[model samples]
Target: MTINRLISGALSITAALSLGFAGATVATFTAAAPAEAASTAGGQITRSEVLARAQFWVDDHVQYNLTRRSNTLHNDVEGAHKYGPDCSGLVSMAWHITANAGKGGNSTDDFESWSGKEYLGSLHDLKPGDAILKSGHMELFAGWKVPSDHGQGAWTYSLNGGPDPDGDGWQDDWAKGPTPNWKGKRGDETWSGLQAYRPIRYKNIVDDPPPQSPPAPVYQTLGDFDGDGKKDIAGIAGDGLWIHRNTSTPGNFSTSGVFISNGWRTVNKFMAGDFDNDGKDDILGMNYGDELMIWRSTSDANSFSFQAYKSLGTTWGNMNKVMPLADYDGDGKLDFAGIADDGLWIHRNTSTPGNFSTSGVFVSNGWRTVTRFINTDFDGDGKADIIGFNGGDELMMWRSTSTATTFSFEPYKSLGPTWSYMNKLLPLADYDGDGKKDISGIADDGLWIHRNTSTPGNFSTNGVFISNGWRTVSKFIGADFDGDGKDDIIGFNGGDELMIWRSTSDANTFSFAPYKSLGTSWGNFGYKILTSAPTD
Candidate 1:
């Protein structure tokens, strides 16, 4: 789960509350009528009412006070009161306890054991109007949105400040919506260690439903959709391409929004690049029938009005084996290359968007024998090189010998044989801030990154970066997602979610430290490919 750093303050409070003495007395509350029993009597509270009550304080800027201490101008129960209730007090008021003058003077621990509540156990089981309890602090779980590649979707909450709404000074009002990082003195706490609970019956509250799961994606891709320097995610479902824009925050993407819904339904194996040399990324799509097409961007990265499709001539009979390579000719244009049963073929872009020379086999002898290959600038040269893995798991490299048309490859250099377990090999930029590019892959064991030693084409296997929890990942893409010059890893699980592991290490080593779940069901998208626009 990606912890929303913005809500860390609230989490800190929960942590503090959790440390409170266990001997504190638990509070007791009157058991109200059940929803079925009170529906006709108008005693059941609608979810909207509870939300509205919470929103009121936020809207009016109610002051915060821990002791329910009243000032002359602002009284505890009066609307004009300068200071509102503390964390527990706000929750108590929202529940309309009616006892303690509706202030709900229960301690944080008291709320955990309150007579009329039920333990939810897991945060996934939380619903609207539930209370999140730690020893020193408590917050209302208003609701949740579908999970995303960034983590569990937004978990809405209603909380009061120990001081101000921003958690800065004293006397803050209601904070409605997703919990923001409490900016107060103790902002380092997190909800990863807290407990959640819900009231069986409270005043007019009848139903508290759990959050709905996010829709499954049909296809996914990574690119700088908005040209914000941070890589964003674009997913396809049904006929629509949903763009989850990067928020410029590490591991976070904006809520999914529809980018295109008409012509993308049947698209498969999509790739992006500056095909026109227009400096904006254009899309190339291949249909199930192996019909190749290009969707040229009209203006910028954010605008994709692919009004007309340019046919790239359908000679892709071996479409399933095709791989989109970077500028293979160093001509400032992207090219299409693939391995065929016959040989490795290259369709060199003729310095024109959507135009390619006739498909020709580049490496005829050994191409058909290789199991996997990826393109990257391995020798600090501007030209892209091909790294391949053979069926026997022997890794080799084909350094580019031609920087122009009529491409050629140097003799293969053996790079060891340790990738037998890897299912996918992805090219990542300098991860350790080292000048050399590194290689990452996904296997049954999860994600493994092999740091490149300063020696050209040489990698260090002694101390490799490995993440075991990523066993469920089926596919992965790499990009400098945070605009930090360091490449980050994004992957799709077999299920509906996408996750990101930001790079934190400055040396050749790597540390995922925390993995952010983008959201669920992204695997529904058939296959995903990632490409970025050319930067001039």
Candidate 2:
């Protein structure tokens, strides 16, 4: 069939077929459009408008704190709250400032003290002046400015800067005391950090905005959606999969997409794996109908198009996710696995896209099904193994050596303690950048990181990350979210948004900032995170 026919067929099958391409909606860098009349009052706020509103707020509320330590701001934009501007406070202030712009400063109580619900879908479609998510804090998306070196890049309104006569320009660090040209260089006037300037609605603003649309967040809600060198914020809006065209200017983004299939409606959870056997990455989404959906991106990033999806008809009720793909079968092709209420389904792909001729299904063997699915070369035979957690408190294993077929269901490796239910599992590469892959998981009691032993599939709990202080580690994903090379963790809190914990000098040790609210309320389950490779 022709490509157009294929796409139309896919769309008709189910909305499960996304615009194609991994997270295609997030197109980076578009030439600034001419400021137009609000075509649709309170219509779908365009990106530029979002950025402008955010910038307005940051220009007003941004303040500096000379007494605060620079490290606080360096580590987290919101870290300076005790001394000065903080991430959450910055967002709160942005709304207050924008609504009360001409009326002098507004009192804190003029708006709610930020229960974390203010910035849900609005943020997912961020523009300049919006907030950039920091590990534990937030940074305001200053307008798109000409970078000192790169000509044009995303500049932030931050605390701790010298005055810019240009009104809303960047400020370099002060080698000496505050400089003379500083616009508002007073203890109370000068802002150490310029927070994001978004046009959020204050309590009684005349043009009070209506409830925001449901966020079409492509980035994993529990993972670093935007690859901003930091896992600071969970996705606010749009899908996480974005394409960056490295032209003279930053690049442009698109909401339209290609190559999607049906069966998405039934699929609720997904995992990224290279299924086309082309060495590039592919994805598997498990839907509500217990079906598995496969999506493929172009090999050449520069000229790639929207995603191409294929439905491998496997039904698992109450399906939650398709785990990160691994080459369980030693065949050169990438192996795929999924989880559903019924059990697990593994697909061994052919060298071609959407072809799953080599596949297998493992029903939940009497034991209550598990929620987590991960791949590891458990048996040192060069081939990888599959690991899963069962509701019956079992750590099940499926090991294989050759890339010929799906892994055989091996015996369960009982990691004692019915109490030690595996909530989430992540693969942490050796901190020193060694080739070994370590395993980390969050349980009810706390977090655990296992050092991979020589034997495949076996890990030693030599190190651990914290799980004790948290109320419920809502959603957690293991990824190099901050681009630090070391694997970091992003988790949803008992509250609305998320928190990121960075690893310290020691592999197992971590340092945390405050939680960032993604606008989703607490107890809302089924959120996840998916990290993507940066565009070339």
Candidate 3:
């Protein structure tokens, strides 16, 4: 017996076989793509439409080898209709998940963060619209080859051409085939024969069964990517993003960053804050269209992730410098402070978790005079305070004193001519292991560290210097990259080199080990949109 096929570029394959890779069109296929999947609330898609979408590729003979190594080939690129032309791309499209910033398709890692996706532990639990997945592969489950044969085999549709009769390892499928779901795992995003293929069903994939539970998210601090209670270094290049997990030991990170998702670089600007007070940090994205969308963090034990973004607001066409702050007005929801319209504005989060709140002016006439400002608790008043340097290089502290929506501020203290030497402020953390908020910044020659004294305004006694030759580092993000409870600094040169200045300090002595190289080819795409992740 022989099977004839149409491949890309009209290539025809004439192969003689007994039960080869090719099979009849799936039984569930509907001739017309149904509208049911496209109109569901909460972005849900129906099971039949998922099948119809998957069948379109098989019918149209999508080769499935274009795994988005290049932006042009990926659905993220504008007008990429192939839906990424890869296994994950096919799933991303068939499942109706958007690529977000890229405007195309989701990568495999993105499934972790997206809300409404559920994991089916074994083959017996899978349904027609369910996906069989590991780290690097995915298959649209059709049904059992035999109703009782699930223990041995089941039917599936996949891209990334397969049919490894030689039994070596995974390769692009010569054509989309009825690749049987197998037992095993693809630990490092690679799968050979039956390597741990588990099942995942989208929470909103309907017409089959109701989900067992709602999506539960793992929470982390603003800078923590993996939700391990330790902040990690994360960033994006092109459509891809990586999370460098902190090993809990100072200066140690997982050599290979855990891939979190794709299409991150598409966000115009990112902000880090938990709008829902979930303890886990959620993301706020500003796109080129001046629209603000929020992607609630949904990280799991495996990777850093977020739920699909929902519209928060729009018309933010002019924010020169913006930082998302949690409850600056003690409103219990997210708020943001930024320098815009020649003044400082406080945009409050909406009463509901999913929409934009109102915006109010915090300082109509004084923000321009402050050369630089940072949000911290310098006065230890149990509320976030503002620390900024005035035109006279006067480092001033404004204690947040308010009992209502109209919060007021008073000049708590000032250390004249102290902060002028430090050109930039690091993230507010206890850098000296003193349990008190300290301040650090970058200067012309190197980095400076100042301790918080018992008194306000006079933060330190002339502080101390950590390193000298920091003239070339372009980006500095102070975070607890290691879970050691002390903050460390990560620096990136103008090029690809990423180095970390691990803190080696106690109560008062300021010190850090020499910069240790994290890796190269970091900001190759000229993107500083990440924390140094992109969530910030």
Candidate 4:
């Protein structure tokens, strides 16, 4: 038989200034809560702060004690409070929920009682910083070692920290020795009997920081919307998104379908990214209302479009000429940037996936003049950077700094009267399969390709003609319509037709395999814009 010596409610903690656990030397500690943090009676909290507070114990090696023992009393973290040194106390302190003057946190029974409305479907739906509880023990959810798998088991943060973390063992006190509690997980043996584990979230847990000064946003990169592992041609027209799936043979479109058909026509442009971290491309764009919105993608192909959505922000209308999409902070969360009247403005994403705050600004000025703006990791620093071209025929790059919260401008090159007519810049895949971004631009005369160098922002080859005699095309997008690793070029020619000129060679040279029409009379679908989902 198993037993868990759980603590009851309203623990009467003594201010043992010198008396430590098991007769040690440390005092009972109580950390001051964060400013504006909620009390134990239940107020709102951010997922980040909850996880942050949990780490503090692991860092200080707070020992687990069944007796009415407090951690410490300091205002370093929040609300000027402290928590008990037990399982429920650890979670309650992590959640900033302690009743009766912060003497002790909630009990196992308290957590179990709260799980009725807080259960998030099941353990599979749990994200980081959530908790799983049974009668006598509870654990802070870290994640699954395999990202997509949940039933296998889970990694957790518990008060006992390690060894008998899953049991109600008579744990050793701090006087004996503190065990590391930060990086710990439960295997099958523990998880099987832990079937009563109730998945619960704090009542006030927000995806990002509380509504206040929003942090600078991070850019959301693109993804493969169709899950084909290859880029597909997608466009926004009227209220629906039209996707033309490319065949194994280039320029041959296999199918046309619509995913998102709600409120898309209100968007001036649409950009694709994995906003929910579900590993699929989600369509997002700012409407005239200034709201930063997202339509989450799912695993289902037939029912994936326009299923879930969120209007995360309302102040984004100020970012005019907006293409604010990229991961500027390397934090794995998508960031936002756009050219406002003053200059280029950026917002670093300080929240979780699919959530954002627009009040923050990374860079406030000095980028309005950049005409041809596009993003690529020119420095190959794992963070995407921006390259720009202007009527001056000069090429430049705005590099993401080491911090990734902002950028620095660097001049790249200039051609005297040569690329003066270069109106559009297309930085596509590694045409030579060399693992570097190949520079491709479109002129009124034809398409031009340049080989990027090993050095940052430097091109080794001159502008070579990929094709000629096609001045009817107005805009172009690069995507691998087929499941090929190589990216193919899709163009909107004559203002009404979508055409694909397939790549024929793998050498430094780019030749076409004849033009194929993907669609015609596309203008009938209203003012349309195009995007291609990326594999990475």
Candidate 5:
């Protein structure tokens, strides 16, 4: 059939298919008009506007032909109404550039170097109006959708034309098809070769205003500090205890006032947990003398006052790298795990809050070279496992052979390399709810999540989760701050601005909502930020 008939047939089928879908709307194709310049003169066009322009063609009977190159004919522009535009032509027209000037009728490779556009490294950097180009092919990224019940990553939506597989001239469809989840080669198609680009505007458009700052500095450890049932933030700076209370929003914290301030300073490292098992989170820190101190929360989840203070001892002086808080012994009390000059040790909670056994040494020789570690149940065996980097970038897991005071570790299982540069690692709760704990790491590129493909010691290397500009993140922590069952990414930008990215994927993947800035100067409060869920 002719290209025009094919596109019309496709639209008819689409409209018919969408009838029962409540919110679905079918595009009404019209005759092609003269090519016109974009509505606004020169400033950067918003993603929405870009999509709108592209949709105009989809709604028009614009036949797509790979070999037939033509510019948009909606306005009184040169080369208007000449030939049916192809995939690249559609993008060029939407971007308001000549087919030869990099916006439309040029080769896919030419668009990559088009003067008016900037190359984006990953698909994660795509905005609605961006273009996704690969060898011999190109498409307009039309944003993404989080399926109502799909336990997977967000599905990418796009607009494009092609060498119609069925010998049909060209079929126009709004939801063209699903793109590959990753950036690399996909089957015969080199999806990894896909490049995204944003058009550089030359018009006088009012730029988007700067992001508003949160009321308070969103400094570290966003846990429940005041005994309230919401996740909060806590940071220490120059003897000042800064707390930002949560204001009911998922990533938002109260900016109205500092939740609490105390005469605590020079805290080199700190963590938060219900050390006392009193059902409320508390703070633990180490000072200049390597002395361990505990600040018991005396107030509700909204505020904090010192209920008790205790110096665990000077033994922590030589120890560093305090692991994440966990109940290692299956006891109801929280314990402190860390690496010391001698080896790995755990300050076993002597069934008392803020108190530990005088002798807290566990596996000695095997831990000296361990760089990063998290105590979690990797196999769902109910016993805590030690997963970490063994100084050489090797990912190794030490399954708990025993959880008693004298814990034993099984022979380390190797999970491969590329783990050395990770600055932060955490055990992500069963993201897919598959009863297996997933792992998340923040490296120079961005946040990466390795879905547990197999129990105990297997992970998928397809972690294209968060990439692009995430290299500048200075600090980050993972927690289901919104009580969504899936862990979220909360971190500080290089400027110490707090940002929270909510999880949208339901499987062993990581796709987050755009980060909402909580505020800045959070890093200035201290290098450590603690995050935890609300306590009863």
Candidate 6:
């Protein structure tokens, strides 16, 4: 896919580190596009096209993965290869179908195996018959959907990411509006909320590569998620630390709860990246006690185990914001970084839990209401830096030096115009990969990915993805949803379902392809989805 050029010198070290995938080697890959023309869409994607693609695939692969596609969530009967349709499995089936639409072959065998790195790049380029993934499964970007209002419209996709991700006809409670409430309460009873739609245009179609070859088993751990023998994954839902198992014929999963809070039932955030040189992926979760809980995998992949070591105490500081993991220290181990209501806090790894120390903290010195946060080094120094928002016009930055314990200064990095408090930033590797880190932020207006080409303490902007009338673009997370190595944006609309936006022109800039409803619409209330790759 075409991507905006990221200036090498201007990017901050933290920003650059954030873009580095923990394990993937950084290849000198480059795209042929300038900063300004990244998000230009040649046409729109439609809902009908997505449905047709999903249906076609499911119809063809009515074996193995899609063998038993009933409209229920029960156990598989004897000899039923694909009994129940869960969220990811369904999407897996759908991607298999869409990948080999016309070519004659077993749908499951024809589709490529999932690859977190390769898929991100392919889907972001917007290939005609590509798939976007949520986790183990995937969804197709049927096409773009341009409504009467040019920017305000739902994306269309073949197969949803929820129960019937493979478009096997099975649906979930969320797919139906007025989804069951937390208290078993029903809110809305509408079916239209989860239906797919279609767009009119498609752009930047690329040749589909042969499916990715699965990586060798690096760590043969027992509680392997994806059953790949590698214990590189860590996840959290509403619960504590868990491992996903994809080996079981319908895929089995298990939770360790090693990092769970003692009394805290609700979990706010969960992420995994190699936090230490330990090889095994470390797990972190935020609890109700304003505590930051950590679990380290001490041994190789197979012998997975943990003990709660670090806790951002109630007295110390509570972190409720999204926590991003990266090796900011350049030590090859990912560090824990995030923002809270009061200030920015980072826990650098000592490689040992309980002994984990704070990187630095920038309080709400001048600006109040520090809610959301992002970690990036705006300047091209080899230190991890921080960026975030407050209830003010200016954005905040805390720049760290090579050996500094705390960041220097520059509270408000002016964005010129007033910014809606709900702005979200998705910082990818040098969209230019010029050794500098580039960033993409989202707001009510549209998407903006810019290359910081100036020196430290200076401010600049580059516009990549921009649309004026995007109605309720919920804060989204960037992941290679379609299994392409290129990062795609997954946003739940003001409605119940989540929309998949694939970058047609650039790695950061994307066009809207309304995906199937995530499942049943839970409620019209706000929901946040953080995508973590789970291998199979």
Candidates, ranked, lDDT: 3, 4, 5, 1, 2, 6
Q: Model 2, which residues run further than 4 Å from truth?
A: 1-267, 299-305, 313-324, 338-345, 353-358, 361-371, 378-381, 390-398, 402-406, 418-446, 457-459, 463-468, 495-498, 505-536
C-alpha positional error of residue 2 in candidate 1 after TM-score superposition, expressed in Å:
57
Question: How well is each residue in 1-536 modelled by candidate 1, as lDDT tens digits?
Answer: 01122123222222112323244432111112122211221234545445444444443345455654444112222242232356666566555454344333555666666664566546666556666666677766554333221122324444545435554445544444442333322112134333333323343466644445321110112555444455556656667666665665554544444456456767776776656654445667777666777776554444545537777767675734665456666666666777767577777776454343434546555577775656665765555677767777888778766656587877887877767767766655556655556777777667777776634444343336577876677667766566565677777766677777777867745876476777776765546444532100
lDDT of 2 by residue, 1-536 (tens): 22123223321121121213342332233212123442132234343333333332232344432322333321111221222233333443333233332222222343334432255354324344344443343444533332221222334444444565655333433211111113432111112232332323322223224445421111221221122222322211123332222121111111211222333333345554445544444555555455656666453533433366667776543434555555656665555555655566665656575344445656444333664455555545556565656655655666554435335655566544442454655443333223345566666557666655546655333455555665476556554434444444556665555455654424334444444333344232234333321100
lDDT of 6: 0.38
Backbone clash tally (model 6): 66
Q: What lDDT is obtained when candidate 2 is compared to the true structure?
A: 0.40
The clash count of every prediction, one per candidate, is 43, 56, 15, 33, 32, 66
Decide which is better by lDDT, 1 or 3.
3
lDDT of 3 at 52: 54
lDDT of 6 by residue, 180-272 (tens): 222232212112431222111123333333446432111111223222333322334333343332221111212222232332236445455
* Cα lDDT, model 2, residue 407: 50
What is the lDDT, from 0 to 100, of the residue 301 in candidate 3? 57
Candidate 4 matches the true fold with a TM-score of 0.53
Model 6 poorest ten-residue lDDT run: 9-18
lDDT per prediction?
Answer: 0.54, 0.40, 0.57, 0.56, 0.54, 0.38
lDDT of 1: 0.54
Candidate 4 per-residue C-alpha lDDT over 88-179 given as tens digits, one digit per residue, 9 for 90 to 100: 77777767664533557677876766542387787777766678877788777755534443444555657642355555543543211112
Higher-TM-score candidate of 3 and 4 = 4
lDDT of 3 by residue, 145-213 (tens): 444434335556676555545443434342243422222111111223334787799877878345454
Clash total of candidate 4:
33
Clashes of 5: 32
Maximum-lDDT candidate: 3
